[model samples]
Each structure stands twice: as structure tokens, then as C-alpha cells.
Target: MKKVLFCLLALGFLGGCSTKEEPKDVTYDWAPPFEEVRWSMGEDAVFETLDLDEEDATLNVNPEKQRVFSFASAMETEVGMVAPDFIFEPGFGLVGVNLHYIPMEKEAAETLAKLEAAYGKSDDGTWSGTKFGELNLSDEQVAAFKKEADIDKDEPVVTIALNQDAQAVKYQECVFEGKNAAILEQVLAK
Candidate 1:
């Protein structure tokens, strides 16, 4: 009886120890001040509200290189902070938020954790700073999807991108789209 009881206790203890806690749903309180102008064609508010100096914000609407407009800025969020280069379509709203934050170890780790939890593991079962080369998650797209799916604000769908280099341990880009899975899939294809 003593041997049986000890074995049972040990099994129970091991089971409990091995169990992994479910990742909590992610919530976002921070969004670009001019998010509403997204997807709006010919909206000057996109540049007007950026509050960035003329030189800092670069507008290169060249179709050859697929460049529209790119600007560098820091975005603060509940999880942490990210400094990304904002890319947008000339007339339409934002299309990409490219970030390179490897020097800031703590902030990068926190950002990675937040993305992993919110995304609930990548389809391929891989985890790296820049897992996907370039990711796109548009805020307008996500919001529309959530609304269509009947998912409320309480249960959010956060979107972020990761880029990994074979030889480099540091992550080059971490893009966070407000709330869109379809857009993410579309941009990740290439």
C-alpha cells in the first residue's frame, strides 16, 4: 500500500509539473494616433498627424522599388516599445510597419513573447526573433475581420511579424499590425 501511494503521488506531481499554462488572450491599448486614416485614399492626415520633421519622413513614391513612403518612429504599447519604419501607399493608408529592434534586448524579448502568446504559435512550430521574412498585419483589415467574425474587443486578434536570419541571432524586423490575419497571410506569402 505504501509503495502504491508513493507512486501515485509521484505521478500526480510529475503530471502537474509538466502541464503548461494556456497563453492568455492579448489586448492592445496603444494604436497609432492617426489609425483612422488608414485605407483612406489621398488622405493627407497620414502625413499631417505624424508630427515628424520633413527630412525625417521620406516620401519616395517609386513603383520600381515598390516604395511608397517610409518614416522612422517609436511606438509605445502596453507590452513595450517598438521603433519601426512606417510604409504606406501613396493614396491608400498604411501597408507596412517595418521594425528593427535587436540592440534593445529586453524590449525585443518582451515584444517576441507578446507576439507568441497572441498568435498562439506559428503554423510550422518554429519560434525565432524574425521567423517570417516580412509580415504585414493591417489595423483596418484586422478590425473588419474581427467584426465579421463577431469577436469583440475583450477577445482581440493581435498581429505582428518576425524576420529571422540564418547567420544572425538578432531580429531585423518585428512588424505589428493592429488586428488582421488575412492581410498578414497575404503579405507573408512573398
Candidate 2:
């Protein structure tokens, strides 16, 4: 009877001393605020928030065409996910932020596979799953497109790109007719 009481008391004490915690307040919202949204905000805003410096980066700009600012090497910056070799364009009114993953490499195939599964496939093998989504490429187009984009050589590979844009923000990589774009050009020119 004493042994039984001791065991019961010990169990009760252990239970009382238990440190089972309610989950920590760990949470992540894939969707940030509209203004805080990557690429949906101004270029300076993005660079500021991400703690990136344009001057320290390798700048590739065409005053009359496109402006691409990339890090000398892969670095962690927040957006859809942490990606390597970040590329930023002023984009018109706050658009055109691209995260280049598996740059000039072949590991992006796994990432693309996951995307394909989530988004599903098109008859041509490019994802026709959603509107305003990444342009799907047919198998043939994949290789040729990479060559055209200078993503890879000798073989067709996936260079996973994440684009953040809002409906209100106009695409400006080619048009180059917006005030914001003009300002970017001026900055890039210097």
C-alpha cells in the first residue's frame, strides 16, 4: 500500500511538474502587406527593407532598356523565399522583382517539379494553371528559352524565377515610359 501511494504521488508530482508548452507564437504569412510586398513597393523601399545596397551589387543597366541589379554572390533577402543572386528592377510604379534560383545550374529542376505539381501541367507541358502566373514553356521552348535568356548552355534547364507584381502596378521592363522608370534610368545612368 505504501509503494502504491508513493507511485501515485510521484505520478501526480510529475504530472504537475510537466512542462508541455502550448506552441510558440511561430507564424509566417506568405502574403506581406501591400506596400511591404516585394517588388510591389518602390525600389528604394525594397532595398531598404531587405538591407541591400545597390552600389555594392553588380549593376547591369540599359538606360534605354532594362535595369538589373544583382549581388556579387548569392545572398539571403526576403520575398517568396530566401534566394541566391537577387535581381531587382524598379518596375513601373512598383513591380518587377525577380528572385533567380539555381542560377546557371540544374538544381532548379526540383523546384520546378514542385511548382508543376502544385500548379498542374498544360498540354504543352508549361503550366497553364493560372492567369498572371509564370509563363509556361513547352519542352522545346524550355531549352530555347533558356538559351535566349542566357540561363544555361549545352542543355535545357530550369532557372526558377519568382515574380511579384500587383494588378495596379504596370510592367515596365520593356515599356520604360513611366515616371518611376525614368527615375530609375537616371539613377542607373549614374
Candidate 3:
């Protein structure tokens, strides 16, 4: 059931495709992942930025090579704090980082608007982020998705994005743990 939710939240938000408007040269005060890390840095730089050591991270079984550093509560970003799995492609070094973060309302809203301005909207009405603006969610879904404490309050958010070779990211589910145990098994390092 949680896997269903995770799969739904992660893979399901991508609605049918359609033609896109020419993107504008928009910028946001926020950034994807981290400015310090950005998107594509060499493995050495990534490991250094995250201060990762073999003792600190375990490699994933993925053919391309992935390392999970379970901060569950350490890293901070403009949007929110996140625990991340830094994925290093054999040659690409740091191509992607699978981040699990609870969204910060004001920041998410602000960035979402910026992304919409730049990429315009999908046929389905979702906006596009430098990644996918698929963080789109109905209020009800957001209500249901938040942790119990967040219900009715709107104090947090959960977002998930997974893609290979650092393409556009699609995400916006707000919880992990028992609810997402199945995917976590595959994504989380030992």
C-alpha cells in the first residue's frame, strides 16, 4: 500500500505530454539540490561536499553506482532539510542525488511560481521546474500526504524524485518510513 502511494506520488504525477511554450530565461533565488553540490560535480567533489567516507556511506546495488548517506536529519537547503543518496555514474561522477525532504511551504510556493514562469505549464496544468514542476498536488492529496502532525496545519512536506543520468526530476510525495518501506529497501543503503 505504501509502495503504491510512493509509486503513485513519484511516478504518477507525470500526466500526458503536450507541446511546451518556449522557456524564459528565468532564475530563482533557490536552486536544485544544492548550490554547493549543484547537479553534476565529480565524485570527489560530491563526497567532499557531503563529507562522505566509506564508513559513512554504502554503495547501492545499482549498475551505475549509488551511495546513500542517511542523514535523515542533517543537511539543509533553501527549500528544506533533506536526507539524500548521492548517485555517482561510472563516468559522470555526481550525476544525481536522490533527496527526501519535507517541503517548506513559503519556499516551495515561491520556487514553484518561479519555475512556472520559466518553463510554463504542462498540458495537464502542472508547471515545470528546472526539473519537472510535478510537485503539483491537490490540496486533498497534500492533506492526506502530510504526516499526522501536519494534517490541517501545513507545517511540512515530502518530495521524491528519481531519474537516471541526471535528466529532469519529478517528485512531490511527502512521507517515507513504514509508508514507503518497499521502495526504501531498494533505495536506502545498508
Candidate with maximal TM-score = 1
Better of 2 and 3 by lDDT: 3
lDDT of 3 by residue, 62-130 (tens): 653444344444466443455666655443345445555445446445544443453454333232232
Query: Which parts of model 3 have CA positions greater than 4 angstroms off?
Result: 1-31, 52-54, 63-71, 102-190
lDDT tens string, model 2, 1-190? 9999999999999999976532222111122212344323455776686677868766666564445565544444332122323333444333233444443224334434544454444233232111111323334443433332343222212112222222324211111112322222232232
Off by over 4 Å in 2: 1-36, 76-91, 103-106, 117-190
Q: How far is candidate 2 from the true structure (C-alpha RMSD, Å)?
A: 18.7
Residue pairs in candidate 3 whose N, alpha carbon or C atoms collide under 3 angstroms: 102-157, 103-157, 129-133, 158-173, 158-174
Which residue pairs clash in candidate 1?
130-162, 130-163, 130-164, 142-179, 142-180
Better of 2 and 3 by TM-score: 3
Ranking by TM-score: 1, 3, 2
User: What clash pairs does model 2 have?
Assistant: none
| Candidate 2 colliding pairs, count | 0
Cα lDDT for residue 61, candidate 3? 51
Taking all chains together, each candidate's TM-score versus the true structure is: 0.42, 0.36, 0.38
Worst 10 residues of 2 by lDDT: 170-179
Give lDDT tens digits, candidate 1, residues 1-190: 9999999999999998985543323223223324443322232555565454546656675563333444556555333455545555432245445555555556555656755674456643233222121223345444434443454434333345565443556554665443233233333232
